[model samples]
Target: MITSPIWLPATLFAGAVQAWRTALQKRVSQNLSVNAAGLVRYLYGLPFAFLMLGLYQWAFAPSAFPALGRLFPLFCAAGGLAQIIATNLLLMAFNHRNFVVGTAYSKTEAVQGAILSFLLLGETLSALSWVGILCGVAGVMILSTGGKRMEPADFVRALGKPSALCGIASGLFFALTAIGIRRATQEVATPDHIRAALIVLCCTITMQTVMQGVWLFWREREQVSRIFLTWRSSGQVGFLASLGSACWFTGFATAPVALVRIVGQVEVIFTLAFSHFYLREKMRGSEVSGLLLIAMGVILALAGTMR
Candidate 1:
């Protein structure tokens, strides 16, 4: 798009889109309840998903339902379910803590996803990768700790049941999304990796957006009006999300699954940075350490990928 450098334009747009999108979501979160806002977020995304699917069909010949096979759908389904559930859990976390803290806790996904993949899919990690995983896990733990709770046991129990479990589970689901997307792209994009990745992602995430929308409508029929009223804020949350997702899919298509995911892990840094400067959330001293460890872990994980 630019004479200067193709990658620079794309990279800058990608980062700006991601950061602005997060900032918008944070802004919307201010007015709407987190649960309701998450719902608003989901519902607004359906049109984009469908639009992407349509464009894919128009640009490239439509293949089978998924350019990938049946397994693609299954993996997508599982990933979708995980995404929705984890999202709700994340919203709940936001209600209890600031978005940055909730997000720091959410970084546990890097560790959980790695562990899950190792166990479920036989994905192996090297020493460096293990270190990355530990850093991410340690950061998450530090964020979740009850620093000043009078009844630490009760506090621990509360976190264990919802906060911690939800955060970790969300990470596992996010990992599954990454792995599943890669697998789908591999299957569908046998010859043309980009098309395969894009089409499968469009189909799978479209279905996810639809299912989430349906569930939200069914549950919140009364609030649907107010939610629709808030559609004005959908520009960034919905469109930007779609655009950023497309970039993410394209990035994954171009690189190794592990490497791409490593770069994507930069979302944590982006989220933390954005949360502080844009949202006025202050980072705790411990949080700074936690983020450092997570960043270290991501580096180690990237090293493992190179091997």
Candidate 2:
């Protein structure tokens, strides 16, 4: 088992940044196509990612750059592609129904990630951790369903809907993206987790930018110009995206992906805070219940990590 103190704080920071970054992305999406909005994070974040890699290497890495194994590029490519697809699917899902449902469905990434990490990377979570993940999933579902008490049949029927299917598929691909990043980090020659993460981040963002750039150029050339025209908002999205990604990559490098993901579910709480405070929304009874469950889940997951 990998034990590192850094992953906890890294994950917390990532979750907070991700909540804001997502909010920003939503605003930017109103002006651009799903693909174009998705590209904003990578294309604008590319420079920041490079800057992070350069600064970290100059300050902390060995005089020579660390060597990446053959699998590194392959893994980065796979991970980038999965993230791209997952993001676009998620954006599509947002348009189909209430934002609550889409957000709740996509939160399935925590549980799916744990399962995938176990199957693909041979990582295992304790029974308590499994329960915690389930609790988190339940909380997310409840929050998304507007905290309504649902009959078993109602729940089953809801899952069969296209919005749920899209959300679930997005979750699956996101799980794959996390696994790919963790595997790629393992292939780095350096033992410094931060450096390894930065290296992976730099490469992955570059590839994503290129892949998405080509698609946008070919299919939506006009949108490309519009994207730059709204650079003020898109630039903020890119900066936050890179910062959030750096934190996420560091968490992946330092601990099991499942554990990192479980801890990262705190993003929901962050979202709740934003909704209540920033949006001047009153907290509902159900929102409070969902919050408590998510908190309990995070606590239990942390406890399991000690075993």
Candidate 3:
């Protein structure tokens, strides 16, 4: 009986893996359109998602294959499409700024999730949790400014920039995606969290792959060919994405979507480290402060969950 908030570790793992996946997807975006690069995560991950399902069935539950409920497909489709839209918007933002900054904007997903979950799922956050969510949002705002100091007017102006708008829009869609997936997982008829996660994951990935594939086939065949030509990188993106998504779905099933996403904001720290070290990007004092704030927010969120 593991009962010490399993969603905590699951969210942590998802955050780390997602940082890697997002970095890879950013690289993939260099060669493909934002939509095409976003599609690669689904198209390549479809097989690995199925493999994960097979392993779960074979190793974890040999005889229990839970059938999908009537509402599962609707929830899954909504989540899948929302994620695709969010990814495309995020990748498009990547075109305008550094990797960490581009992703930092989308970190607003945590704050957005808090609102959406409350309205849609009747979920409420503790006072400390609200503080944590606000801290996380503050951190993202600081980071998204790319260390540039600005006047109040300039700060307001920055929010109106195209990349900033994309990032904010991505956050909103991602919030919806998280809520939809949580709903889908709850609709499952199984007690096994792993099985439920895998089922939802396989269905969601398949839906995304088909939807993106058909769109690309008609509108961007050359990009489709480029995806295959760059299979090695695309495969890395797919594997990391599948692994991260499995963890995310499991976390979503176990906890409130807002909490899961708030904890997942730790990905910005991971992305910051990746950008500084691997991507050889320089970090500024403001960015460092933002990272520290994010760390504090994550700690506060976890502490709230413990209450």
Backbone clashes in candidate 1 total: 2
Per-residue lDDT, model 3, residue 71, is 97
Order of candidate numbers by lDDT, starting with the best: 2, 3, 1
Regions of candidate 1 where Cα sits further than 4 Å from its true position: 1-17, 30-36, 47-67, 95-105, 140-161, 250-262, 275-284
Supply the TM-score for candidate 2.
0.95
- Cα RMSD (angstroms) for every candidate in the order listed: 5.8, 1.7, 2.8
Candidate 3 residue lDDT tens string, 138-174: 8877887777775556545657677778888999999
Identify the leading candidate in terms of TM-score.
2
Comparing 1 and 2 on lDDT, the stronger one: 2
Model 1, poorest ten-residue lDDT window? Answer: 1-10
Report the C-alpha displacement of residue 127, candidate 1, in angstroms. 1.4
Best of the two (2, 3) by lDDT? 2
How do the residues 28-136 of candidate 1 rate in per-residue lDDT, one tens digit apiece?
Answer: 7676655566665556765776677677666666655434576867766665666667777766665554444454457666565566556665666677767766665
Compared with the true structure, all predictions reach lDDT values of 0.60, 0.87, 0.85
- Name the lDDT of candidate 3: 0.85
Off by over 4 Å in 2: 60-62, 97-103
lDDT of 1 at 11: 38
Model 2 Cα shift for residue 278 (angstroms): 3.2
Best by the lDDT measure: 2
